[model samples]
Target: MASLAGCLTGEEESENTLEVLHGWTGGDGAEAADALFSAFEEEHSDVDLNNKPIGGGGNENLDQTVSTRLNSGDPPSAFAGWPGSNLEQYDGVLGDIQSDVWEEAGLEDAHVEEAVEACQFDDGYSAVPIGSHRMNDLFYNVGVLEDAGVDPESLDDVDALIDALGTIESETDATPLAMSLEAWAILQTWTVVMLSTQGYDAYMSFIEGDGDESAVRDTFETLEELLSNYINDDAASVGFTEVNQDIMSGDAAFIHEGNWVAGAYINEDLEYGEEWDAIRYPGTEDMYGLHIDSFIYPGDNPSPEATATFLRFAGGETAQVAFNQYKGSIPTRSDVSTEEFNDYLTETIEDFEAASEKPPTLAHGLAVDQSTQSSLEDVLNNNFADPFDVDAATAGFMDAI
Candidate 1:
């Protein structure tokens, strides 16, 4: 691991410095980001890389920080962002990168087709993807499940999951489910429940403004029940990281989070399949809840060539594999082998490939625009704070979009 000073300093200062802003400042995410930049700096010895990480929280915090920087006219040369509607917000400011960077890296054939397509905006490709995360992962402490006499493979849907939760609650003192009260985390749980109950097409249609209202209400109601019945009582005071601790310590049985949890577990030297294991969120086996972390060049970048080089490196095999390996995400490139990854990632790769439908995740800023996402978040936060009201929550969700 090289220090930040080493990344920015050299005998002869490089001709250009690429300033990159991203939100991977903790745990394995930080380590992976650092490794990528270090490799990039080594390969392009004459180019200096200034890696700026916004560390307060997750994507929402990073988005706010990036927004502040952009508004203040101090945008970085390049920054990490999501695909789909999220990228649309920076349309004019984000460089295409497809013609200049993607081709140069030979990523068209190297990357997964869907992953590449997700980066494309109406105008053109607005970003370069580094990895793909399955947002609908349900991770559990293997020992906890075993102690509770629960069969990990037998829990397939919401009902079975509830029964297992009951067993865990009755047989062991562990919290049946670990969750965070963070707006995004709550929304993630809500989205998974909605997808599970309403089915894939309906879930997509509802988010897009044309689906069954009854189904939506039912999903909300079920989510409320699940939260009220199964989650730890102190969830409101904790964040996802704390919930992760609950899982690792056997204080909680399950956590419905993205694959990033795998990275955290790996960083702690917890073995996959032994200490922790993952499965698709119940009833989501046929679907891939997609989350992609990508980089985009800001329009005001001072060094286009340097930024282009950085994007090229990010999308290439060497950098993508190196980054995702530590980051606990599958490489965005379909051609990349999983030999370096753990068993968990190998299983995720298979799931990502076998899924019949792939939908963007609302929690991670892919399914909707910022305004809609914010509106929905407000409703979800309100619902999480108060007693569940299916009618009221459904109405609020309808109004959000």
Candidate 2:
């Protein structure tokens, strides 16, 4: 079990200890975090860093645990989190790190535009981003596309994509798109559908809470058709990992997911650009849908100096490169080089820079607050997935968000 006691503000037993709560207990996430932790320990040998990893996809369990600790006046010195309004939940407890970390660590100039935007609040900076995951990725199996005589590069728009799905269904035995009906999965696909069909401005308007009802209905209609027609038969029963498996085995042609899916491919020893590939979601080439994993500074900090050291390390170029290599994300620092990463990451780094807009993803708590995320998830997955009700889904989204 992880310790509740935080770092040494000279009052604690472990005077040089620093506790960090994160959700990277297994697989590539764990490996990537271990690399980061090892590097930190190597640099700061005096401080005993308590690495508390709470296992859960999307930090579902970890977030609640951190909240409980913070409420009990036992906040970790630093904790991993998403950027944007997600930080507002812990507003009272989160301390201002603008001068301590942002300015001191040179993050203001080094980090990407979206990272800076997400980290800043009216009062002060809420967090410092460690990595950036592009959420608008459509991954596909190379051999399946080749055998079906369909060119992945030719899919320039939703119409082209729909026609290609038809071509894959008719010409090959592979499933057109691997999917899932798990609430988060449904919400994830729905977000992509909105971007691919409604375009960037419409997607942004919806995320910001003043969505156009007609466009919302239209996006819902498009998602309903895509989920109803092209996805694998077992989509309702499977999840994201299963979908990745289906695509890699050539049983499915495509799966729309975040760049974190790259870690799975890397784990399997699959070659990028040859065995599989990812593209900017059709109709979203100009927009980079981003999901950032960051770290927060808490007000109940046991060791302010220790936490500052940790934050400074996290924001450094060396640490960013080390953490993101296996974490399945690109460095939030734009200065980090792509030569150290795989082809997919290198391309994503370029795409992120060239894109006109880097919009935070909705399902992952980057674009909206935690409440809004839960509301949308419940509204879409429960009302739309099983029933495929566009009117109800649109109505729920229009009201809830």
Candidate 3:
């Protein structure tokens, strides 16, 4: 793992300074970014890479930060973010780098087709995907589950999951589920619940503005049940990292988060499939919730060539493997072998490859535009803050879309 503290060092008056901004402040995310930037700097010593990391709870704050910079006409050379409709917001100021970088690096042929398509818009590619993450994951503390006499494999559906939660709550002192108060965090759990109960197509229909009203109500009711009963008492005050700490300390039993938690566990030297275990978020066995972390070049970049150089390096096989190795994600490029990844990531890749239905993660800016995402987040946050009526919450959610 590399350190971000002293990674940026070069001539003060370097001819080309690539100001790269991203949201990876600590743990494997930061280490992966640092290692990528360090390697790029070593290869291109003449270009000063000013890598700026904007840390927040998750993509919520970082999205606002990057949007502010771009809207203010002071965007960085390139920034890390999600692909798809999220980048469409900056289409006016985003450069089409498919030809300049991806094609130049021969990524069109080497990368995964879905990953390449994620970066592509009506006109051209707006971003370069570095890795792909499975958003629907239920990570558990192996010791805690064993102590509670619960077999995770036997828990396959919502009812079984709830039963397991009750068992853990009764047989042990551990928190049943670990989660954060952040709207996105809450939304992640809710989305999984929705997909589990309503199925992927129904969930997508709701996201697309038409779906069963009963299903929507049921989803909210499920969220209310989980928040009101199953989760940790301090969930409202904790963040994802703190929840991870609770799991590590045996204070919490399971965390419904993305695979990035695996990176944190790996950073702590915890063995995957041993200290911690991962399962598809209940009822999502046939579905793959996708969250892609990618880099986009701002159209107003003063150093386009230098930025292009960095972008090219980021999408290459070596950088993708290096970064995703610690980030707990698989490379977006199919050319990269899974042999270098851990057993957990290998399983994620296999699941990703075999999933019958792959849907964009609602919490991660894949399913909606920025405004809608914010509005939906506000609704979820308000409801979570004070358990709201399912009918009222459903009405509010429909209005948000």
For lDDT, candidate 1 versus 2, the one ahead is 2
- Give one clash count per candidate, in the order shown: 0, 0, 0
Model 1 accuracy (lDDT, Cα):
0.83
Worst-scoring 10-residue span by lDDT in model 2: 1-10
Off by over 4 Å in 3: 1-15
Residues 1-401, model 1: lDDT tens digits: 98554666452234277888888988658888887888898888867678888875566677887888887877788888887777767756666677888777788888888777778876677788989889888999999999999997897889898999999999999999998877788788888988887888888898788867788788888887888899988877777887889888989999998888888897788988888998788899888899888887777666778888888888988888788888888898888878888888888888889999888898777789877888888887786554666788888888786
> Which lDDT values do the candidates have, in the order given?
0.83, 0.85, 0.83
Taking all chains together, each candidate's TM-score versus the true structure is: 0.94, 0.93, 0.94
- Candidate 3 on 1-401: residue-level lDDT in tens? 66432454443333267888888888658888877787788888877778889888776567788889888988788888888777767768887787889788888888877788778875788788899888888999999999999999998888899999999999999999987878888777878999998899888998898867889889988878877888877877878888888887889999988888888887788988788988888888888898888998788676788888988888988788788888988888877788778888888888887989888888877888777888888887766555656777788788887
Question: What stretches of model 2 exceed 4 Å from their correct place?
Answer: 1-12
- Candidate 1 regions with alpha-carbon error over 4 angstroms: 1-15
Q: Model 3 misses residue 303 by how many Å? A: 0.8
Question: Top lDDT: which candidate number?
Answer: 2
**Clashing residue pairs for model 3:** none
